[model samples]
Target: MRPLKRLVEQFLESEAKGGILLFVTALAAFVLSNSPWAQAYFDLRDVYLKLQVGDWVLKKTLLHFVNDFLMALFFLLVGLELKREILQGELKNPRQAGLAVAAALGGMVTPALIYTAFNYGGEGAAGWGVPMATDIAFALGVLSLLGKRVPLSLKVFLTALAIVDDLGAVLVIALFYTSQLNVTALLVAALVFGFALLLGALRVRSLTVYMLVGLVLWYYVLLSGVHATIAGVLLAFAIPIGRARPLPPHADGVAEDPELHEAQLELLEDAAREAQSPLHRLEHLLHPYVAYFIMPVFAFFNAGVALEGAQVGSIALGIFFGLLLGKPLGILLFSYLAVRLGIARLPSGVGWGAIAGVGLVAGVGFTMALFIAGLAFDAALLDEAKLGVLSASVTAAVLGSLLLWKTAAPRPS
Candidate 1:
């Protein structure tokens, strides 16, 4: 429980900053798009930037690099979190993960169905997956602002659900969003993957080896027409799980200290104190990168969507209802049905109100939704989709915050 509390604290702190950046960038994009400099703002995103140092040269639009390369790192961090949780956190146990899994599935499916219902068999049907994601940083950020009013169980539920939501979003992107595949590039990607797997099996401890191979994998995947971010997830699985356990020079199985006799207990304590286990060290090293760099950069890049002079019609209404209403209903109903059918149990200290509020929070799909929207449509409908996402996400964020804030009794210091 102590470890869980600490994790929550760390998650909240980082999420607060990341969420603010997301909101600010989004707002800036909207304002700039609507302002007199709208045409220039649009052009600037497409303006090519190039860097050359002798034979080494790199070129891409600012948006392309940010969306393609930087976002891959973001997905990498997400993959790490998912892996950690499945290995040692709340998701390790099937029973413990049941409620969250059910809720997340419910949240995702319901919004998608609602979206599909509105845009069925039309150009908008491709956008069904847009509302299926839950932005963890923003949702957690809103919860954090409410302080101790929200219960710890609610927070835990939201985190687990969001992780599941992320998994679903990734799958949707890979399966539904992809177009024609480049078989040659895919073959190369497979070869690179095999090398990564071999390194993992050999328990290689050097990150440099992984980094170089990961870059190759990313390039191959990018060309293969599969989203490059998928490479991040694949590479995360390949990271070697080894610990650095330093052994001291032993003298004929005797303790180095004259005062301490040759005792097994003494040796064990020394080993424990000196050895920084592989999992422990990797987690420590990855934590700061995930919390600070990967998440913030992703937010800064992906959160930007032009919001000025947007239509407020069926699209906006549909999105708003799907997130704020449909999400909670779908999540709660499916979860309830699952429990009633004897498939799962409600988490301890978690009630209807909490679950409902979490469902609403899960509706806040600002980041992932926009990314999927970009893939679902060409330039024509992109603006409308962006408008729908922005309005729905804003609505979900505010409603979820208010709902959870009301439920959380002030905890005494």
Candidate 2:
């Protein structure tokens, strides 16, 4: 338990630093997009890339490789984090998880509904899922700016909420954004998934073996037209949650010798440490790469929307208002209802106003929103949606920071 707690703490600390880097990279991207080097930026993203093995070949632009292949790694990390939280982190307790769950649901539903009201039965209706995401890195980055003005409990609450929000986004992508299905490929993916599970059941702790099978699964799922990122999530669940088993008091020949008992216990501890599941190891190893490298590169590629001829029409307006207005409104309203109904209680040292402020911060839905926009709209409408996401994310970050700074109590001197 202490080890798990330490791992979570390390995760948050790295995330805070990563958030700063993400901001810097996004800013650089925006600058490059609007400057004289814009054509070079676009050209770099459009460069064709291909992989061939024998007669089989896969081809895509550089940007698609980033979006499809690299982002799948990002989602793989997300899935591992979600699994860890559910198994032993904050979400392990029902009461502790209730507030985040309710807040995430409201955050997702209200944004979708608000977007739908504007684009219902229209071409942009498919984009209702765009504003439903919360960029955890950006939101936490903003929160970290406040120093100790915010409580640790509040930060944990926000983190949990964002994780739940991510889960919702994953579901939406799997259910709504998927293209045509290929049954044969899906069966192949299933067979690979089953083999991975069998490895876990057999307690094969070699990460190399699991990863090899996972790559096969990812390829099959990619061919199945089910949005290949789902394969990452599926692979995550197959990884064993190997908790350390306690050493029995009367093991082997320790009954008559106290020193031998202590020696045996130490050996057991060492074995237990080594027995930690691949999920934890992979999550730890990949988190830094995902945060510092993959995400910043992703932002550089995806967030460079040209503002010269960009028009903010109804689609953009819907996304803007959905993120800016609908996010906070739904989060605060549902949270209040949950508290009043005794479904969940606020964290200690946190007030309704702070929660409202956090809700506003959750509206900084940049990365995931941009990714969904790519899926939800054509090239023409994609620019409009990106503009809305960029504008709303900035507004939400500013407003939420102000609200929290003004309302939060100062730390004890």
Candidate 3:
């Protein structure tokens, strides 16, 4: 249990660092997009890259590769984290998970409703999912800024809530953002997924075998038009969760065998340490690359919105209100109701004001919002949505920081 707690602490620290880097890269992208080098930056993103295997060829812009392939890796990491939490981390306890789950659901539903209210029956209606996300990196980064003012429990609550929010966004992408499905490709993907499951059931602990099969599954899912990132999630569930076997009790004649008992206990401890599964190993290995490189690159490629002709009318307004107003309103409302109805309770030292502040922070929906907007809007309206996302994210971060700063307790003397 101590080891697990330490692991969680390490994970949060890493996430905080990565969140700061994400902000820097995003800021840089915004600046570069508005500078004299804007055209060159755009051109670089638009450059086509092709992959060939004999006569078979696939081509896409550099931006497409970043979004489709690299972002799949990002989602894969997310899936692994989700799996870990469900099996061993925060979500493993229903009492602890209830608040985060309720908050995430409300967070997603409210933003969609708000956006849909503004764009109902209009061309921008499909973009309702755009504001449903909470950028975990940005949100955590902001909380980290407050230092000891905010309670550790509040930080953990926010982190867990954001993760649940991410899961919701992934589901929306898989369900709504997909193109017309190709049955043949989907069947192939299903077969591969079943095989992967079979291997896991057989306790096959080889990472290479799982990865090879996962790549094939990803290819099929991509061809199936189901938003290839779903493949990442599927692959994650196939990873085995290994644990050390419990030792049998000592024989009756061994009543005085203290040395043997101690040695057995040591062996058990070592075995348990080694029992960590492939899921943990992969998550540990890939977190830095995903956080430091893939996400920053994704932001650089996707966050460069040209503001010259950008409009702030219906689509933009919907997005702004959905994030700024809808997010906090929903999170606070649902959380309050949950507590009132005995469904969930706030963490110790977390008050209504702090929850409100965290909800506002959750409104920093940059990366996922941008990804969904790209899928949901046409080129003409993409910039409008991007403008809204950028503005709302900045506004949320500032407002949330100020609110938390004012409401949070001072550091211990």
TM-score of each: 0.85, 0.92, 0.92
Report clash pairs, candidate 2: none
Point out where model 1 deviates above 4 Å: 51-58, 241-309, 313-317, 410-413
| Candidate 2 error regions (>4 Å) | 1-6, 244-273, 410-413
Per-residue lDDT over 310-403 for candidate 3, one digit per residue giving the tens place of the 0 to 100 score: 7888899999999998999999998888788787888878889999999999999998999999999888999999999989999999999999
Off by more than 4 A, model 3: 244-273, 410-413
Q: What is the lDDT of residue 100 in candidate 3?
A: 86
Q: Candidate 3: which pairs clash?
A: none
The superposed Cα distance between candidate 2 and the true structure at residue 229, in angstroms, equals 1.3
Residue 8, model 3, lDDT:
69
TM-score of 3: 0.92
Can you give the lDDT of residue 310 in candidate 3? 78
Model 3 superposed RMSD (Cα) = 4.3
Please, what is the whole-model Cα lDDT of each candidate in the order they appear?
A: 0.75, 0.87, 0.87
Residue 156, model 2: lDDT of 86
